[model samples]
Target: MRGSSGVAATFWSFLSISSSVLALEQQPFQFEAMSVPTYTLPPLPYAYDALEPHISAQIMELHHGKHHQTYITNLNAALKSQAEAVHAADITTQVALQQGIKFNAGGHINHSLFWQNLAPASSVDAKSSAAPKLLKQIQATWGDEAKFKEAFNAALLGIQGSGWGWLIKVETGKEQRLAIVTTKDQDPVVGKGEVPIFGVDMWEHAYYLQYLNGKAAYVQNIWNVINWKTAEERFLGTRADAFKVLKASI
Candidate 1:
């Protein structure tokens, strides 16, 4: 067990040093009254080597530690002064901080979904039972799961550059309506008043190394591990008052 797979060691290095935010973690916040939860990447419940073949070990390590953690680090820093500025009623200060929070926070949230959205492609069973209720919703709304997958994959692949493809629930008439949304960069789905049930990461770093130039192959493989159960929970379950979803136990 002690043979240094270079996997665990590299992961720690990426988390502790390579990540942008972890370094700033020591810088104490000047104001403590800010009502924002400091954004951070939740530790994945599985191992780096878990999602291979379809996605390489190198990509997972970099995506989780360096890319995801950086978002959390930057978001926390942005929130540090927000409390003081808001308390003092400084219009300009509060306004300026909005863009930073949205971008970095979006990065944090989107990455979280990105991680959850993937699994070892091997786990995919094309004939698995689809929850009756979930299936009914899909057929009525998007014709069928196959069609939905096609649309989802197409949208995700179409993102001009770094961003996300989302299956969101929009509010209308008294119930949440199902809709597909493509968020550019790290923008939050909630900001646009859509509740994101599932999301696909389309960033170059998300697939470039593993798939190389094979974008369609990457997209096809992602659906194999789509966490249908989690998607149901996000859709039917309740989320926190302000941007909080009780961490889904893996």
Candidate 2:
């Protein structure tokens, strides 16, 4: 029922569909029938306060528990509605439901990746050394690590409103490169041959309580908690590896 205007405000509890869920980005979510599988918010890999000093416990609790859960809740609602619309052959209702599905679904996918993309600030995974291969590609693309972070932070700050900033590994033919990209609102990086190495949630809810209006501060401190080991894995693996959590989560 936590949907936007113009959509039905009804929600239903659903049974877990499949034990083997495909990587979300690789398998675009489809609404076929009433038997759709429900999405659940995956738990954080570390404690809520694990990234302390850089990201607050309060923010992590609300961001993961409340915000991310809302996306799953609403996504289930929208998908359920889409199923009914399809059954009735009501093309109008089905068409009107796409926005909610895309927004909430993107929110779920983005946050799922975002949570795994971070580590405890003191963990070795947080260090650039944990990602030598990715670091080399970054250096090749942006001159050096410092320049890469500088460019990524600039992209984060330049976002006009709620969105995300991502460090993505792009491949074309025999060429491979690292790039910084941004997605508006709850939109996700779902490009072919592109793997999202790590993403920073730029929504005000992500940093407003801790950083207030100083989003730049939030952007900078975020580097200290990034899961570079995970980044290295994604950069070296296929796009499916970037969202491997989807295959494990309910």
Candidate 3:
């Protein structure tokens, strides 16, 4: 009887250990490096106050440091979850995470471009003359700079809610055209053959603190700090060149 009892106890202990090993194997395996953040915020290309008078220092501080960083943080979290989902082959969780990834990724991409699209109001790069080739293209499309500004500002004001206004260079085979386009919420300007030459953030956080409810004034004054040099480069460069800002962040 004693021998039979000892054998039964050993069998049960072995089964328990085997079950624990199997359970550990079934859990998603994560590398130590996976715990580290996959994405980080890029430094502002210029000082927070550089676009002052047109865009306030306080707004820049909050928008770039707080708002933009939140997007990065959320995006990293979503991606980490996605990696685990992929490892576990959890299709349902992967699908649910798509919207989070999209929104946060778009926010990062748009803001990366936004910072480069601005310069000090007093800098020569902020002047329209800094973009002669782009100016010619704009003139051909909108008759002249003034008319283009009018059309662009109208697009900015026409946005029903939080969004963005863009001056995009569209290419069709051998031909190219410049168009004023708007993207709703955190959606990016990502159509094929489209290169975003410059973008104006229409989200209230972009202008609300300084301008109060005067959104039109914010639209009108943003041009004062528009980085024409960067616009010209994006206009002349390929779509890949335009998105290099995003790659650099990674």
Candidate 4:
């Protein structure tokens, strides 16, 4: 009887230890199977109506709340469905997902920057001016601020379809120079070996409600709210070596 009792106790103890070991073995697999990150639309830096007169409140509401939200949703969905391919670094799968990722990601990125590049015209101090360094650079590159605006507006007005006009700083040999460039669709300016200082959305949705096919007028008004302070910060913070490899490849 004593022997039988000892055997029964030992069997139960072994069962308990085996169950614990199995649980421990499954933990890493459970962790590894965790879901991929879901991207969300970021909130505007200012109120929806903060950029009013230049950019109407209704335009801001639709552009930020609806259009931008859709991009974020699609991006998250694409990333989630393609998690395995992305994790394995599969080139074919990555190529398949690239366009969708770029379009949506570009929309999100572009809109975010656009919001930061504008402020209330009322906020501008009557006596204040653009950061002196940025102003000096603009003058040097385009002869004067007026000429720069003329060139920038011309570039923006020339976009035949939905796109953005950007004022970018490119490293030329040992020095950086300002240039105006346009990108079709929702393409971003970064991969071109340039740092974008200012950008204006030339998409109809950005102005059609208020300007009604008057893209040139829309471009002109946007400057009233342009955030020169932000542009100056970007210019000052840029490092000469930041795009060294990119410049070399070019």
Instruction: Indicate which candidate wins on lDDT.
Output: 3
TM-score of each: 0.76, 0.86, 0.85, 0.78
Candidate 2 segments whose C-alpha is farther than 4 A from its true place? 1-34
Model 4 lowest lDDT segment of ten: 241-250
- Cα error, residue 26 of model 2, in Å, equals 22
- Which ten-residue region of model 2 has the weakest summed lDDT? 6-15
**Candidate whose TM-score is highest:** 2
lDDT of 4 by residue, 126-192 (tens): 1127556878888999999899999999999899889999888786566778899999989977754
lDDT value, residue 13 of candidate 3: 55
- Cα lDDT tens digits for candidate 3, 1-250: 0134444544655575576456545654544334433667889989999888899999999999999999999999999899788777899999999998989988988998999989999999999999989999888889999999999999999999999999999988888888999998889888989989999999999999999999999999999999999998888877766777665576
**Where does model 1 exceed 4 Å of error?**
1-37, 122-130, 191-193, 241-250
Candidate with more favorable, higher TM-score: 1 or 4: 4
Please give the range of 10 consecutive residues that has the lowest summed lDDT in model 1.
241-250
Model 2, position 186, has a per-residue lDDT of 98
Question: Against the hidden true structure, what lDDT does model 1 obtain?
Answer: 0.68
List clashing residue pairs in candidate 3: none
Name the lDDT value of residue 205 in candidate 2. 99
C-alpha local distance difference test of each model: 0.68, 0.83, 0.87, 0.74
* TM-score of candidate 3 versus the correct structure, residues matched by position: 0.85
| Residue lDDT tens for model 1, 1-250 | 1123334544554464444444345444643422444655788756887777667789889998998888878888888777668767887999999999899878887777656555555554222243345556777898988898888888887888778888876655457667888988888787444667778788888889888888889889877666665565455543321133213211
